[model samples]
Target: MSEPLKSEIAREAEALGFDVVRFTSADAADGAGAALHAFLAEGRHGDMGWLAATADRREAPLALWPEARSVILLGLNYGPDGDPLSILGERSRGAISVYAQRADYHDVFKAKLKTLARLVQTLAEAEVKVFVDTAPVMEKPLAAKAGVGWQGKHTNLVSRDFGSWLFIGSIFTTAELPADAPEEDHCGGCSRCLDICPTRAFTAPYRIDARRCISYLTIEHKGHIAPEFREAMGNRIFGCDDCLAVCPWNKFAHAARKTTLSVREETNNPPLAELLSLDDAAFRARFRGTPVKRTGRDRFMRNVLIAAGNSGDVTLMPQIEGLLDDASPLVRAMAVWALSRLAPQRLRALRPFLAPAEADPAVRGEWLEAAA
Candidate 1:
């Protein structure tokens, strides 16, 4: 395709609500394999073992589909107006990742990617495929290569236009397109993102240990949360966005123009009491079209129980009390821990549930320890 055609496609992408669009030859992403190897060698990927396997393929986009000649990186800004991190101190409420505080980005981003790809195909001749986070595409590195943003020290892509709140998507195609100049890194001498991590998930500049990342634990880890990090999780019921929220660059971010991505009143700061009471069906209904539904009720509640333990509100004891008989042993176990942190009167009220729980040896031990 001619350079003019590429420019027109970019203009159309912007019109479709994408903040930035740039092109790169699929063969240009050669450094991805080595960086991924080093990242995996340190076990920094945590339980996300998929990254280790896709290292080679992710390194070069052409490897995924040899027929693809160009990759179009798309970025959408989802920046919030206020400090998303400030809500962390409100222990009685839940802190959701800023991106997740509105509509789910996957659905929003994928629809936009599809629209852009269709428009590109109509203007130029080529086979096109759309990918958001659903594919093995290394969006941050590719976005940097495409001039959409630079990957900051926190390892998330940050752009001058969208700050650190942009959602990345990509279109791999058979058309030859003019590529954009790559953006320069601007995170000079700034360690705010690294120092702000609750679990110190960053091992060094630009690398995050997914295992230690609260986002990974609360949303992706299916089993019981590792005991050591439970207390540090605070009341974040869904994904944690502390690192992204603390970035100084967000000051220039524009509020999401689309109301769909704007913060919903109920989601911006949900009451902890209300969130904990959601049964499976209610959880699904309430979180419909939202990212929290991805974690399912069990995993989400596991996070909630950890938060309840940290709440220091004896008034929540009754809600925590009812969870003792929850079918999932993980939920029951967390209830016992939350009970242990309750004030004396509330703890006394929990004794009846603890006494019957003795048949489950694990529950018995927790009950004995909390009662003592």
Candidate 2:
């Protein structure tokens, strides 16, 4: 039987637009399984319980599928062309994560992975499966083991070539492909990602307390954002990128190949007024295929209202007026909270509309207190 030519397959993957390619023998990740277990036992995953439940399966690819003999880890670089931190000072605008500024990466990475896998199948005689954060398999450690990169202190894979801007995917197969030598830890003294967290989500050098993570708070957590995090959130309406942006390795980061990920002129720092005007339909139309879809309309508007409140721009009162009777009471309540932060005159002007409106009692109570 002819053995698979791993180097040839990796070249094909690079030609297919994958920035980095690597191969790892199954069970190579067993060494990192202990740290993963400790991470879960400490309840560091927050509400992402799937990470905990699938811990065993994730630590060992064989546990997920005994038929797999090899794992191919691929990294796609989506590094920003400019300093992502520059957007933070534009308080009038929403700051989107660099990864989210373009096409949905899952869609992009999966299609690329599939194309690469298909080419590999034509070259070899084994069955293959492709995944990009969609499976229980631990692609990070596997990528590190395969010499794609090292697991940064932030736990995301980082590379001298790609920085930490890589999006990882994998193709698991029954073929016995030769494995690449693993990369050693390069973050010996770097803690920039930890100190830069606005929410202080990092519990240690490498572990994150997802509950306080801004990405989790703005994108994942439902209901109201906890009061403590509201002020620190600034105007980041969708996700946080502080950890990724502050990494010194990003100096070597490459520019994105296409304008698709370029921040849209309107989206780059969307005026709080315009965002407040979006009803569910407008919100859906504006954000289709974007990562912002994860928040849904109501949650997104709630965040916008918080930003409006923080903007200290009393001129936004008119926009807040429209959302007072918004279909989502959560939005209306937040609107009231934001409006209250403005001049007493602005609050007085909104009293009649807010007083007669039959909104949620909790929200109404908040509105009434603001009126007082």
Candidate 3:
């Protein structure tokens, strides 16, 4: 019963556009809880307090859904066609992460997961619960257990066929399907993922300190990014993908089957000048259905300002100066920093007017630092 049913489910999932389909028992993941606790204890998660908030449910499958006995893990590949790192040399452009260069995968995977979950319910007469990356589900560990891929040294799942580019989704079911053989780690002595980190985010082979990670600083960290990471950030205005792009296993990967998930031009390596010009409404309308919209205007502008400062294109001073008066201090502080870098004299001239009335202490401090 389990054999034929699992095969049928795999076919349907493939038909539904999932690149990889595999199964695992709904058992607790080996050491994910211990790792989570250690990560939280060290304050490595940064401002992502949600990781600690749902620590219990994130530890295991049955902990979240006790009625579950089997888990169906799905991998939807969104690998880029060309070198995702190629844009780094184009310092005047914003190098967005490959995954976020397209439409938001969370919405793309959720619609498909719901469709697949219904088929699983019919095939086994079982109760099913679906989860995407958003939930408390420990997706990478469970994906490894289900034979989708091994957890790479950089702590993301690395598929033999998809490299580190698979977006994981899961269906936890009550049906007793046999688990697939788990994949063993193939990282060997390669430290490309670890070495490629501009901010030295990897504490060890498999652990990451997110607070120092560029991905965290640019996207996750709400406050002003630290001075140390500002230059290392280069022109990556959104998430960083250096580790994933350098992997040797990407040779086997192909471009995504879904065109909607491919790297769209506007979000992929677009010019810093253009991005710096975006107002709140313009930012929303431009990135409407994409992942960039979720980061919202103020934070996104802060990142763009960092890119502008690093660009060495003094032409962006006007736009940087404009943001110095932005409503969000998150934007104004970074603008002050960027202005000092691109046009120190201009920033010094404006400091007299800007610093006195500044209500936000952080922005005022940026003004003082610019003077000193």
Output the number of the lDDT-best candidate.
3
In candidate 3, list every pair of residues with a backbone clash.
none
Rank order by TM-score, top first? 3, 1, 2
Candidate that beats the other on TM-score, 1 or 3, i.e. the better one: 3
lDDT per residue for candidate 2 within 1-372, as digits (tens), equals 234588789788878877888888877474678887887888766777788888888878888888988888998788877888887787666777777777777888888889988877777778888988868888888998899888888778888897878889999888888888999898878899999898889888878788888888877777777667877888888888888888888888888674545555545657777888887789888877777766799998988887777776778878877777777877877777777776557777768866676657868776677777
lDDT of each: 0.83, 0.80, 0.90
Question: Alpha carbon lDDT of residue 351, candidate 3?
Answer: 85
Model 3 lDDT-worst window of ten: 259-268
Q: Identify the leading candidate in terms of TM-score.
A: 3
What would the TM-scores of all predictions be?
A: 0.93, 0.91, 0.98
Backbone clash count for every predicted candidate, in the order shown: 0, 2, 0
lDDT of 2: 0.80
Q: Please give the lDDT score at residue 20 for candidate 3.
A: 93
List ranges where model 3 is wrong by over 4 Å. Answer: none
Instruction: Compose the digit string of candidate 1's lDDT tens values, residues 101-200.
Output: 7888999999888988998888887899898886887878888888888889988988887788888899999999988888899999999999988888
Q: List the residue pairs that clash in candidate 1.
A: none
